[model samples]
Target: MARITHGIACSHIPVLGYAFDHGKEGEAYFKPAFDGFGWTRQFMAEEKPDVVILVYNDHASAFDMKIIPTFAIGCGELYGPADEGFGPRPVPPVEGHADLAWHIAQSLILDEFDMTIINEMEVDHGLTVPLSMMYGHVDKWPTKVIPLAVNVVTYPPPSGNRCWALGEAIARAVESFPEDLKVQVWGTGGMSHQLQGPRAGLINKEWDNRFLDRLVGDTQELRHIPHIEYLRETGSEGIEMVMWLIMRGALGKSTKALHRHYHVPVSNTALGHMVLEPVDGTVPPSPTLEGNSAAAQARIA
Candidate 1:
């Protein structure tokens, strides 16, 4: 079966993409920010994953007010970078694993997690910026990607617990796949910052660091944090933190932290990054849970 070799979490700020594209890395203000990804890039080079299950939210670029899908999985053969206002970032298009994507979508729906299977979609900064942060400006992405877009922009987005559970469901789906692929699930967006109204430039470094601590040591407790608290304390957009739980959940209960980096004021967002691998260097075998495929098929029928 395909194994989950690593789990990564990071903030996906579009300005970071712009900075890298415009050769602003040496600038004093952006140096620390760029430095944060030094270790992550090295790690990725060493332990190359065959595929990346990228988790991010569309910033009203792809899915606007017309239709909002709580969970959308890209099953297309390829996805183009979206022109979010000022034309597309000069990044190569993302290649997708259609067979694996279709398998994951089928399993997720059967597991009762209603998902919108997307055959074609334009991926915006939320999806591509993380890729740039991870692999740098490459001729082509190092690996294929399965873009999993969550509806964080819409009010009353999926709760933290729900996102965590979905990650678990995705883990099950990935483990069931009969392949020798090395997969890594990435949860992108947020440490803490609100970019609207009078509360525009909010940043809670204390809360952000505390979150990173809990995420590394006590993830279950961190998963229980309410959305309202995140909104009230961390700032409205800070709720994006919940998405990280999905990556954590997919890594199983215990993981070894290979590298971690945290920096503040990256275009009004607290930039955070971490690389986690399964403790035993391989995912546990799929569990024979109560939900049998026959019963799942019956439910689907």
Candidate 2:
């Protein structure tokens, strides 16, 4: 069976790149993030995963308020950067893993996930930001990517539980593929920092620290919390912390943490990264439990 070589999670703030380009904040913070994921770049060089399931939210670029699908899978041959008021990035168009993507889409729909399959769509900073951070300029992205863009903009987006379920669906999709190749799944955005309205720049050091601590060992607890609560406590836009659910869902409950890092002051965001690989061949505990409190059942369901 082809295994997930490694999993990574981070925020895709396009402005972070603009800052690095314009020399607003010193390079001290961003540099380490790129270097620490050096293994990712190297893994791409060696393992050259045939597919990278990228989970990111679109920034009103490709799919505006017009029609926001809770989960949209891109099967396009190429994807360009969105203008998004900042103008498109000067980077080569992203290549897609059509074969693997189609498999996931079909499987997800059969599983009743109601995903939107896109063929000719442009990805915004929501994706390009993390891509740039993880992999610098190269003649071409080493591996093909299966873009899964979730709608975090519109009202009543998918619940944190739903996103977590999608991660499980993703694992199943990869496992079902008949190909012999390595695969990687990435969930981008949120450690904790709110940007939007006058409440922008709201950073809760205490909440952020607690969230990180639980993220590694007690993610099940974090999933039980409601989205609105995250907003009230963390901030409105900070609810994107729900995005982290996708990452937690990908790892086995008994997995070991390889590395972790946290830093604030990325413009107005808390930059965070964590890498989790399978441990001693132990399978992750099932997210669902047979008998649990109504709340626990609700969180996993």
Candidate 3:
């Protein structure tokens, strides 16, 4: 039967797409952040998931200040990339998994989560940047995607606990599907960075690293982190990290970090990525950052 096989979490910086489109991925300015994705791409190629349930927030491109859905799922034949000023990034449109998407939507609503069902919505960089980072510049994404857009952009977004519970409901929904499909849930956005105010260029590496540690193992404490703490310690936008909890919750009862990378100052943002597989052992080891302090080493091989 269809089942959640793994979880992937990463920051989705719009500049990553710009660098990729301009062939600046290898340039000195962006190489450190881009290099961190190499192991992820290789890992995805080896154990390519049939579908990816992408959890990300929508930028102004899809929904403006007028209205925002706390949880929205895209159930369309295809989801084209949004045109964020410089035209849509040159990546292939995201093909949707309708059957699974519908099933998930039905399951979530019945489970008491008010999920907005969307038939038409162009995904912004929040969705595309992570795909580009993990898959590289592919003509077409290798797997089908089910977009789960959480409303972290607007004030009073879903709580960390709520997102986590939604993910558990999703796990149940996926398990009920009869098709023998391999699935992966990806939580995109945020390590730690504030885009405005006096702390515009903030990058709390220590707090971000601590977050990565809690994310992989100490989920009980991690999921309980208040929004105010994310704002106070990480940054205003750091609240986006709540989306990762949904991905973590969907990963069954427990998990271990198989591969992880953490880098800083990627366009003034901390870029973090991790691959979590369900683990039967005790809580996974604290992310033993290797190599240098600026770059956390990846161990997928």
Find the candidate with the highest lDDT and give its number: 1
Worst 10 residues of 1 by lDDT: 280-289
Better of 1 and 2 by lDDT: 1
Task: Judging by TM-score against the true structure, name the best candidate.
Answer: 1
| Candidate closer to the true structure by TM-score (higher is better), 1 or 3 | 1
Give the range where candidate 3 is weakest over 10 consecutive residues by summed lDDT.
292-301
What lDDT does model 1 reach? Answer: 0.86
Q: What's the CA error at residue 162 for candidate 1, in Å?
A: 0.5
- Write the residue-wise lDDT of candidate 1 on 79-135 in tens digits: 999988899899999999998898888877777788999998999999998999999
The runs of at least 3 residues in candidate 2 whose Cα sits more than 4 Å from the true structure, single-residue gaps closed, are 20-47, 217-219, 280-301
RMSD of each: 2.6, 5.7, 9.8
User: Which structure is stronger by lDDT: 2 or 3?
Assistant: 3
**Candidate 3 wrongly placed segments (more than 4 Å):** 280-301
Model 3, span 153-272: residue lDDT tens: 878987888888777778877876778999999999998999999999888989988878876653567777888999998888999999999998788667889888998888889899
Estimated TM-score for each candidate: 0.94, 0.85, 0.91
1 against 2, candidate with superior TM-score: 1
Q: What TM value does model 2 have?
A: 0.85
Q: After superposition, how far is residue 114 of candidate 1 from its true place, in Å?
A: 0.4
**Global CA lDDT of candidate 3, please?**
0.85
Q: By the lDDT metric, which is better: model 1 or model 3?
A: 1
Give the distance in Å from residue 220's predicted Cα in candidate 2 to where it truly belongs: 1.7
